[model samples]
Target: MIPAMPKPLTSLLTLLLIAMAPAEKLRSETTTDWPSFRGPGARGVAEGSTIPTTWNADPESETNDGMLWETKVPGLGHSSPVVVGDRIFLLTAVPDEGETELNIAAGGNIDAAKDSGAYKWMVLCYDADTGKELWRQTAHHGEPKATRHSKATHANTSVCVDGDRVVACFGSEGLYCYDLDGKLIWERDLGVIDVSKYDIGWGYASSPAIHDGKVAVIGDDPDHPFVTVLQLTDGEEVWRSDRSEVCERSWGSPLIHEVDGVTQMIVNGFPWIVSYDFATGEELWRLEGGGDNPIPTPFVSHGWIYITNAHGGKAPIYVVRPDARGTIKLDSEEDSDSLVWSVERGGSYMSTPVVSGDYLYLGNSNGVVRCFHAKTGEKVFQKRLGKDAGVIASLLAVNGNVICASENGTVYVLKTGPEFEVLAENPMGEPCFATPAVADGVLFIRTTKRLVAISEPE
Candidate 1:
């Protein structure tokens, strides 16, 4: 039996105004197409789209209500799909036709996957409207230089698009640039980026960011951790900053934004969070103390930059002003001159938080979701989505609903408000580790086996 449709939020007009006003002013509006990770500016909020509240995505089901189409993507990948215009692009690593597996569950196992002999790092493009394979290019083919976690993948980073060019970073493999038609323009070898934890190989997952014709990538390895910016046109090195002194290791991506005529890139890390000038790679501001194993990317919303991380008994949320300078080490939750407000706890470990209306939504790997006041550090409400359900993908806010996908293959649509209310719970019928992407009116979900597109029935 099909589930009933979820009720829409009551404050639609207020949310539309509040979410779109600051988004438009900052030039990070989540429009019809999602360009990068968590959409533009990593806000994870989409507008002018209709996302289905319920769906049966199981291919063999007799009646597939909200399922538009599903296609089998080769091999394993945790990279989320990125949509630009009518094209969708992603990356995957295919072993040499051997038995490979990904443990899609909630556990405390800190072991690496068995070494697959050789892998083909591939770049695939598809027609967004029909889920048709437009083209596929082999970026590289060889044995992996670094090991991956049992729950992770070799293709862990999502691809970013700028105009007609798309960039993919395969960690230790290399960074490849390609045209929209599967033509390789250039590639760069950034050395061996072995992202580990406590001397254990856990793999790399930091994605790339594009802004003002420059591509930025962060490699937080045990040794020689750095942030490098290259020209998007020809892959020319603009500047690279050494981050070894500030952070030991990080898996979070870089966030680029323009504030008061200054372009700055912010990165989330443990023990310290830093911001650098985008043009010259000079240090602009730094914040001391955060979660240990940082994974969530920093994003801007409500005229302030929001950064969060978890692990090592410290889960903090820091809201900083865009025009901040120098170093800041928080001693309390009070509002500093540069940092608007901070909280010592209540941050997600893997899932990135999303802001909509006057509330900010966050979820941890345990499927415990919380809502907080966006401007001030006040807790609104906390509720568990489901027992035994785990969330690794980030949250998505669209059409007045917060989309939370669990590793147990369920997507919960919660209404946006201060009170706790779950409008709908839809199952994807497959494990999901990557975040969902929305474009035009279709919702793209990269499950463990296939890429499923959901939309309202005609």
Candidate 2:
């Protein structure tokens, strides 16, 4: 008989086993649960699922080919819907005294919305298959600690799930955790997480990321920016690292990835893009220079980490190695060991690019879509989807097709390849700021006023 292993040794071995596995393999193979923003590992790819390419967005249309069901979602929110098994979870903020509207456009407007009142920060769940309301909970209710951009919403961060627990971050309001049955387990106060630009409040949009029984959060407040890790089981603080000096403000979500036997939480910022040790919150690597307004989350793909930002006259796409350390120089030549390949321009301002098959697809806010070689920084093609359609939602990959949703409510589906081929252009009628989620062969999209589930109708 073999001897029993010690608890500490067993835990260490368990971690090693997890670290050895690829980030994609960490998720269950039986069910594709889009538990966070841009899906598992933030890769934005749903394998073995058939996402609908065409659908009728009209509510009263009888010939709805791919329309499954759309349920009315109350209030305004930019938080994308998350999926866990058979339920869909999301966050919204409904004002108690006044109503606010979203300014959906691609122009250069830095004004704050003229709206403020006591809001009910709500957590809502719905049946994934039927689009029926499951339950809703008010996480917090009061006036916001800060204002939001004209194009931003009070609830801009997406919720994340870890099979058993659901977590939502309401910027300065609070962070709350709940069970699958809508039972409140715990909540944490993160103080005033004011994410601003030039002393103007743009509100916070970074979503909480969960990995291996822990949750990672990025609070890029201008005064006290930080990256913190908390226990997902009970919301206890595990570690926190300050970034007041390096980072000014950021709206992107933190990414948790394990590469080269080390797990790191990567964040995007204006002057510095930093990576921290996931377990201890220690600063591991840093890169300088990118778009001034860092709104795109960093993702790992094809054995390289991809980081992109576009604003303030500098649009760059940086592809770095997983084991990079210290401060990497911005002038490093392409194809280098540490810096990999980087381009000075052609990065998206709002949408996060997605890599599928052989090309990486990027969509800008002004309806421009570009495709580049995944391995080499070679531009394949660049085309405009529409005249003024704003593509704010990040790109999505299903099987071999890329889904691009514009601010004008049109969902463009294109076949993945070096050639530019649009498969379909379906309209959603209302504006769409939140990114869509996919799970169990269904597409769940959050428009301005509803959560619509789309699938190929039989």
Candidate 3:
């Protein structure tokens, strides 16, 4: 080694190196972890992927198109699979009599399971590569204190994984935190959250979103509606903002978007589409018009935030700028002062719309798929999916195709563009309601019976 530099020269070099460094290093998200509800930022866009056009659940096949492994999950829940490095995490509720079938369209009017038994709220882990299960941890074991919607399970909320702990919210049951090795870290009980607007019991289904080392969850029940954030490292309340008493129940999940230089958490709710400071729970802006029950999560893309909900008195798609403030209530769809564009009609119901480049894809509750210009809201094409296939899960745009799945477990792959083309209709042969998670060249699909990992052969 050469002799050390002069003290003044060394100091100058150190300063130069420090200045060259980025002020804040952005996280390079890899295919290893699916940290949240819709996978990374809930964008529903898998990066650099060539997803299979056709897949089969049957392992024994003469052809090479299906699931790599089909591992039967024990319980019934609609929570999507959250994948981490080498492992996939999901939650389920195992009732005593094994209630398997549910019709989400029934809302809260359907009859509950006859003589329902104590439920088992479980946290399960599986090997990502092969569908081999890794571990199962019991988050809660008791009779469900609060009755869920007839079409819902006790574990409608999905589990979220931070770097250190995986969080699972069982609505009225409790919120649980577990280490990667199935050890209990912490748990919080937020009481019975009966999220019914019309005095009908539609259980809570909002998954927790983790941002800036804090997990934000919404309790949009008619009884107690509030937005609460907890420390990710340790289960401590960072902030809790009480929502308006007039706000009806909302099933949409909270999402955290880092726009420009500011970070804001956007929440979808009735009577208001609210944005809050990610660090503190201070309200940033509130838009006052949405459906009576907001089920679609807010989406952020292309430097614009999109919020929309249908099946209410007002159905409007508000594309707002990141630099918004106070009240953003628009009088009509022609309000260009605050909104970039507003689609007054043809919004999503249960499915959260996804943006693939310049096009916006909407999959309705009745298996109807439509595409429109994202900025102009001009209709491109509207088509129904496979026979008797009604879509409930949100559509995903992956590898130049839109993946639209129906409750009948058929995934319709459509070519993305102004022209309408049905690419393929792959059958899962099981009941499905959750959106499939795509990462690491594998599609993790959760059905009513099992968690299947599908990938093309080498």
* Local accuracy by lDDT, each model: 0.88, 0.88, 0.79
- CA deviation > 4 Å runs, candidate 1: 1-31, 332-335
Q: lDDT winner among the candidates? A: 2
Regions of candidate 3 where Cα sits further than 4 Å from its true position: 1-32, 58-64, 98-100, 104-115, 332-335
Ranking by lDDT: 2, 1, 3
Higher-TM-score candidate among 1 and 3? 1
Residue by residue across 171-255, what tens digits does model 2's lDDT show? Answer: 8999999999899999999999888876788988999999989999999999999989999989999999999878988889998
Distance from true location, Cα of 365 in model 1, Å: 0.7
> Could you estimate the TM-score for every candidate?
0.92, 0.92, 0.89
Order of candidate numbers by TM-score, starting with the best: 2, 1, 3
Query: lDDT of candidate 1 vs native?
Result: 0.88
